[model samples]
Target: MGASDTPPFLHDAIWQERIFNGDWIAADGGSHAIVEPATGELLGRCGAANAADVARAAGAARAAQRAWAATDYKQRAQVFRKAAALLEQHQEALATWIARETGGIMPKAQVELREALAHLHEAAAMLTQPKGQLLASQEDQFSIARRVPHGVVGVISPFNFPLILSIRSIAPALAVGNAVVHKPDLQTPISGGVIIARLFEEAGLPKGVLQVLPGGAEAGEALCANPDIAMVSFTGSTAIGRRVAEVAGRTLKKVSLELGGKNSLVVLDDADPDIAAANVAWGAYLHQGQICMAAGRILLQRGIAEAVTSRLLEKAGRLPVGDPMSGTVALGPLINVRQVQRLHAIVTDSVAAGATLLAGGSHEGQFYRPTVLTDVRPGMRCFEEELFGPVASITVFDTDEEAIALASATEGCLALGVISPSVTRALRIVNRVPCGHAHVNDQTVLAEAHAPFGGSGSSGNGGRHGGPADWDEFSQWQWLTIKSEAPQYPF
Candidate 1:
């Protein structure tokens, strides 16, 4: 998986070293052999950081934080603004790289790049806002309340939605004056990790302000255990997120998690079956359904169930599934062979349990076809678990009460979408769900760069991410006061 093994199309000359500390420093832990999900080829080898490497990265970021914090807010904003421009300029190549490396379709890959750039620009704007508040307090004294950076941020990003998910926190953490040590998923070092470091570097960001270490969970554990990392932001599975939170909690370190989701999309009786089906298709199958916000379960009112399922089957079958390198592909392969097997098993077991396998339930290597299932009941695993692949479960409900009950059944509450002819009707059903983000007349897979995106319960720790709200996780509050005149006390 080195230069000698990686195909020319997948190799990046700049990623010879996997550690960044003001410069691309070499760290000798071991080599993580990356695999191309689309073709199952050796993509490249990235350096896997050991505990000592993680310590060194933390030290570099700790030293850089004081200087970065002292830098003017406008200057910080400028860096991200430049970074955003650079990202825009390279959007095409970045999108292509993501498609080839991660088995993502071109259109969705482009969206990931666009959103990543938008996050940078949003952070730039957020940093420009006033940093402190003048308060009325204490007689004859002027009081000011201010926020400051936590000094260093340890970021752990997942493989899916590599660009946007990492940038969601990184851009804002930097904007608010924190140096960051990021660990992208071991599987996607080049597209997910190195590209981020290069963008900030090309923007003239100060050395040591940001460093990326590509590796597995051990590296992330090392980063979390480091005392210098004041805050840790993680986006991954709920199982792993709990581990991160537990480790960070031991030191009482600040932690933010954007974890797993098993969200649902509801198609009400009043909705247009055609539009609802299309939205469901996009929500469930986009990026091969790897997104945390993707709809794994789709609930429909009894009257519209057959109509919507017919439309969904038509749309799903019409969409092309092939090599992501092909421009005509609407869907691409799963991220890895393991995921393909897992998804196929889920669909197979559901069908055995009497759930109808509507569209596809087959694969060739990692290239899994878009799968749809209907008549799924609670006993079926496909109806309950978060099948983070190209599989969607459709359930029909006879009443509004039953629809809300079914949609709220999933353990994760990250997000949900409800479609109805009347917005009022949609809102009525959506409001009853435990979801953190509820959208009307839209898919569950919706997020804006400026939105405060996060969830409660199993999905997240109720921490706000994106926009200025992210500052809450990366900063600290301090109150300062001064009296114009000193009063003499009868001591």
Candidate 2:
């Protein structure tokens, strides 16, 4: 595949150009070729933005912020509703782009589209909700504290779960009347940037309200450091997220960081091994375990450790891996070969450190086999690191205290899950782990448009983005007062 062979959905001027100031324009850094992760073939070309390009985007967003903020709230909401409808009309085509570009199976791609649509609908609903609360004043006057837009919000999304992550922030920011300057990951730009720009454009969003610039670190840093941007929403690795916060903090911009996670799935002795294995497989291997909420650590109580390990091994061996576009397979290629090397190193190091590799510990090209390891101790590389791949490490624990300690050991505490026959037992374990999201008798991988989602510690800052949380993440508050007449002052 090459630029000439680009899919019809992406074969347009908009797909190759940067979107800002209501039109597609050339970037200062020329163009970069997008490669299909599964085949290593050229997918197409996308405009690459530099610092200058990011500055231009910031200026455009700032210029349009006031008018968009002044627009009627209901009308602003209609734009999102229209965008959601348009997404439904083009869901199949968009999903195909996601599958091909991200090396995700068709089912996973459909889920991303569904969640993205849900985000849009939820954002539309947010616009119609109450904006402020009235308060009683000590004097004969009325006072209120109301939410207001942050002017221009910079959105930086990652490649994994590109569509959902991007829209989760973009839709809400726009709904609350803030202009956006977006920078989608360079690896998967079309599905994340061009598609969003096109949807909003067709949905009657005014020019300059939403700017999409697909770029690398240079552009991302520029967007964060720009003086005009009042806030930044970032989703990526914790290392990069910290850098974003540092840069944006210099200017005192509100920053929302949704970073990495070393999530765990705790299997209690009272749980059925078969049921636990199913959830573990799904949570640990979905989309090749590329999700931030993936179950990287599987902590098993000693009593049921052997049973669950056996079932997990069977599940791992049966999962099919191949090119997603050519055939039906449960697991597809990772984002690139670099990721495969990193994951394989972690598995190899763990095995060397005495962790038993019960099942697959290898890969062919970008397609890594679903791997299972047992006898993994806390100090092993696999247990300590964030294995963002289709690899699960099992650590046996003798008691509930041990389980909680092992599950909460990782610095990144984004998602945690507990499986037990008794809901009370599961709740006890769930409450002990400090994570942004938790599931009882379920898997770790989960997200909803109407749920508050984020993390603490190394995972992210305390900021969250979803449902009512969106009001705080994307906007600020303003206090107002009214009186029938001027009152006497202290002076």
Candidate 3:
């Protein structure tokens, strides 16, 4: 179905109808139609904003920031609590929106909603946590330092995982008393725009404190470069992230980025083949493997390589591949046809370079069957690149040294996993690597609301999201001192 033939509710959704500042308002520019990748059905449309629209949104956020910041921390936390409740109440609807908009399976979409809720709850708890610190000084003097919000934050989110990524920053930024001007991806405007804006409003969040402007590079660049925006929190590809960082840096804006990953899952000798394959399959195929921390490269110790490969092939072959909206499909569509084409190109190129296509390298519409390639060597495109799809590139290594070397040679080190019979050996491998997050006897795609999230190398700039730690990313520090006596001077 064409977007013009959209369902009434989706057609009238906030993104389709208007942008948000204090209320739903029409964009001066126009609208861009959105379609479901799974069936080429018109999902809806979002505002196509230019620099002027972003400036308008930033202006509104700026005007609202002072009053919002002055509100008590408890009051802000209360609003988040209400928002959390509202999110839970609308979980089913939100999950469906995510699935439809992002081509994620319903179960995975539901998980994203749960993660958003977890983020909201985690952000609320952050308000009651200890502020900065008290510093030791002279007997008659005392010193203190505390975090302060940066007034207005520009959140530039991505198309994939729209719900969680947008909320991941939005919740924490608001909890710390900062107004936000959000620029969600044009493709995911439903879950990222109208739904989020309405939920915050219904939760009694103050007007103008949160604004949604769905658009493309123009809007994102405007938000990043706007002098009024105190900081930017972005989640997307490394290339785009670098561009965002460049613009934000010109203004010296405080920025936090969570970029792409070409993560590794190492299968060590003596590891149980069944357990390792299970973990690897989930990490590689969940959300159709569009995750930033997916297990793109599966490294196996030569001793267990054949056994593990057979097990992984068995699991991938049996894995359900179908419509994302289906209630039971294990893997879903990629976000769009372009993404489908991109993954296929990597597979074709890798095979041309002599990589063996072990199983499943074909597509039906947006659904690409989970693919596995063996004999993938270090210099191949698939080995060196981030496929960002449900394709697993396998390479065998003779020693731990060889495995670690190959893993380290990738463009990124966002996440890594090691499976070994001994926990001690697994940890040793983890210590030898330099990724953002590591797991033993687990897959690379693990994250929680309370843990610090980021990556090293080209994965992301050295910044973290989630939990109380992100407060530093959203806020600034100020030092204060008091003295009862003022007689001594070191100079």
Candidate 4:
């Protein structure tokens, strides 16, 4: 059956186009269209809310925040557990939507669906850990430092990995008893968001504690500027993130942003091209290179640059690209046509500036063929910018010093992968890369659920959302002191 003939499961009654206030409120104006990027077919439509609607959601979150904050950690954990189970029961539907909307292959979409559920379990487990500490003080005096939720948090997610990234922000915020107003990416909002809202509601989450507002910049701006929201957690472009930080900064609200990346993969001369190429191929092409942490830049040692690049090209050619719903596909289309054009522009500019096109570099209906470029320099669009597509820019480095310099050349510093047969060389490269996350002999995309996930520099702000440190980002530290007796002082 053709993609156009497939039923629009998204338009069903399950997605009750309403804003959560324990009851369905009609969707506000500012309508947006959802499309299947793979075929450029309309999937559904979402009701966009204006500034007033965003404020209403924020207000509801604030009211719920107070009561949720007073709930004990164990009770909060129980709710997350229920949510996890609910997702597990609905895995088939959730995975299908993830594949359809985000244009993710079945395997990758399944992985995200399973991992998202596990994340909720981990968040629930986080509740069991220590939350406060007693400081050493003078006799008969007590001092305590507690990690407390920052009331209402506004989470704005990007289009790539919608389910995973959105839930990452929401899990931590809600786990710590903070009410959250989530604004999913306008491109693929309906499917992932409707599932999330339903699961949370079925899991007995308190109404209004978590609300989904699906729209564009207008809704995002409203949520960010709301005074009731104590913090903003954003994962998108650095340009927008900077603006969000500025606006939130004026309100004195804490902001955590995981933004753009031109992340690099450094392969040493001693590395085996077979292993390095395979790992790099997966990192660069997974989800059609839509991932922000993808290794778009490859700093190859001059001795083995050709061998590694050749192997990577061979692997990239074999990956099947088609509709994400098909089980046999390895890669899917870009999230939308705009993404396809942006990636093409990056490659076109790079080639025009003297970079060599090493492999596949074509686009068709939002689908970008896996591509690699050689001789990429600092000024080229592919080298300096974030190409959120399946294009890898390879540059040869004569020495370790040169490799480190190339990795650090970009404004983004989210993650880097150092591949070397020698542990010493891998350690050296990992230490030198100026990024928040680094991997040795592996792709940068391999993230453990308990490890910190965020970036440094323009790639992100200094905050994490998926590790033991995640709770720390959504919370504020409060110090309390008690005195056993009053002391008399004489001047």
Candidate 5:
């Protein structure tokens, strides 16, 4: 695919320029080319914003917030309802763009589109929910505490699953009456930023209420430090998240960081080898293992380790790897050349450290085979670090206690999966691990729009999205008091 092969929907002006103050305008920082991950082909170009552009976006969001907040709740809800309908109408085109840009297969793209639509619908439902609580007050006065928007929210989303991640924050913030300035990953500007801007625009969102800027680190840092932005919602790596926190902390701005993970899936002795292997294959290799909740490590009980490993190796060897846009393959390419190199390096380093490469350990161009390593210990690079690629490292444990210990060894625990014949046995291990999401007899890589999604420790800052958590994360409480007459006070 070349520039000429760009999707027809993306030819619109909205996809080529920065969306600022409800208008499509050129960015001060010029533009950058978007390359398709699977074919290394030129997809299109999107505007790249500079610090000045971010500042301008922040000003616009701040200016529009008051009137947006004062809009009728039903009207606010209608915007999200319209956007949700539009998402359903354009699902196929959006899914194709996701596959080409993110190197995800068609099924994965469909999943992302469905989740994004759910987010919009959830945001619409949140509009009519109770917003405050009545409280008893002394001195014959009535009092209440109500939720209020943060004025301006800065949303920074990552490349993997860009549509769902970006919309989860954008829809809720806007529905709750906060203006948003979104900065999507440069690698996926069209799917993440352009699609969102167009959806809201068609839904009749007012000018200046939402601004979309596709840029790099300079723009992200500027958005964090801007005085007008009251809150920052970021989804990326922990290293960059720390920088965002540091910058936003200077002005005491609220920051929500959803970072990286090195999640684990535990297979007990009672688990069927075939079932356990299926979970491992799906959890570890889906989307080429680029998901933040991807299962990075697999812990198997000693009695069943050999059986499960054998099945897993067979499955890994059979999975087909190819370009998602060109063929129907189980696995697709990594996002870029750098990721391919990094993933290969992690596999080689682990092999050098006594890990037995059972299935795959090499790559051709950007497509890395579904690789599996057995006898991987805690100190190995693959065990301790977040390998955002198609690699699964296995370690055998003798006891449930040992399995729990091994699962919790990593610095981040975004997700955990436990497989056992008995639900009670699975719960016992799941309760012992400290993860944001836990699954029993299921894959680690799972998410729902109505669930509170976040992590503890290095994975996130205990800030959650979805359901009631959205209200807490996007709004603040304000106390109100009412009386027939002014109360006397000492002067």
Candidate 6:
């Protein structure tokens, strides 16, 4: 059979259910069902942890940190290596579970799983790198700095990339000898949280070093505010992340927050509309546009706005929207009914604000048709808000300056994509956009595991996964100084 012939429900499996410590017993309380967004079919049920549960998980993590930290760096690297190997060995099953539970198609789900494993492998290799640096001096004295792991980290993960993002945060924190208390987004608890737990166990990690407390926002808040937690690493909305930062700051704990974005894709006059259409359509509609880096707004040169908009609409209309387990289905449902309502509100508010919908402002079940809007202004919700759905809004720009101004107007700027034939123009726009990640020839959603990734402004205040920098995030630098000859009698 061809790739399109792959069956639905291909990756469903019984998740291993257990408590790594007594704290986990309290953490695993209420239950919630994981549903395939494409078909509204139940994938599995996961525990919906409460504030008490988060506290328990935090206690477990705190209890485990000293032992994990005291282990040799090489030993920790070995555990990461073993986890990477196990993940590779079970790639098929993991990918399948992701596709079924998160409503990610087989190809996309497989890519994320592979990327997650590859990144973990890179983390394993990076663990061997020497920490800090030695400063050269005229005398025989030596001065150096070394990095040490924090005690315990609380990880709050999002749903769009339940496996990779969650593991991306947890692995680096754990590899650096910091135990982690993870609270996964409710929409993908089983797929991300449970699968990762299985890998950690298989790698022979000591019990209580990594705990998964699956639940909603309250659980995350509880985890973030715990005084026993040494740090909080969160990936979600900007407002919530700010609250987390506040709590962490009040308690004098460290924090890293990767928040929301109203990212943009700018197509210049000289660019190819066909290519631009393809990239924008995929960027806006993939995973139903639930990605944090989704191109929420598109700025087109007036010369090509109408044509590019037309082509983009046609491409989006042709995309398959059905059961996510179906290999041929390109578009899936929103994560839940609440997300559906949010998308509706964005569209409704945009229309009420005088923007016109060119296509699709409707929904049935959790499946929303790809929507496009025109005549959008700077203040409209569709143009300003982080509508985490397959919705795109367009406004024509006369010059590069105008495009840059419009793109930078939002408080949140994570990633920017500029399509221009001239390298100089691309570089110019890249410099103008106030974002952490910039793509010259492609869409904003494009990312590599080894590349540095984060956001500026409201997008992210803390950094996690991304190339060599990930190691820096997980470890703290401490300066070490020693004199070779007692400073030659204090001369």
Q: Pick the candidate with the highest lDDT.
A: 5
Residue-by-residue lDDT tens digits, candidate 6, 190-217? 6678778777777878889988888777
Across 307-369, the per-residue lDDT of candidate 1 in tens digits comes to 999988888788888888888888888887777788888898899999998888888777777
TM-score against native, each model = 0.95, 0.97, 0.95, 0.94, 0.97, 0.92
**TM-score for model 4?**
0.94
Off by over 4 Å in 4: 1-11, 483-491
Residue pairs that clash (backbone atoms under 3 angstroms), model 5: none
Mark the regions of model 2 whose C-alpha exceeds 4 Å error after superposition.
1-10
Sorting all predicted structures by lDDT, with the top scorer first, yields 5, 2, 3, 1, 4, 6
Model 2 vs. true fold: TM? 0.97
lDDT of 4 at 159: 82
- Summarize candidate 5's per-residue lDDT along 162-232 as a digit string, tens digits: 99999999999998999999999999998898988888988999999999999999999999999999999
- Model 1 RMSD in angstroms: 2.6
Off by over 4 Å in 1: 1-11, 485-491
Off by over 4 Å in 6: 1-28, 137-140, 462-464, 483-491
lDDT of 3: 0.86
Q: Where's the lowest-lDDT run of ten residues in candidate 3?
A: 1-10
lDDT of the structure predicted as candidate 4? 0.82
Worst 10 residues of 2 by lDDT: 1-10
Considering only N, C-alpha and C atoms within 3 Å, which residue pairs clash in candidate 3? 3-42
Looking at model 1, residue 384 earns an lDDT score of 79
Deviation in angstroms for 158 in model 1? 0.8
Q: What is the number of backbone collisions in each predicted candidate, taken in the order shown?
A: 0, 0, 1, 0, 0, 0
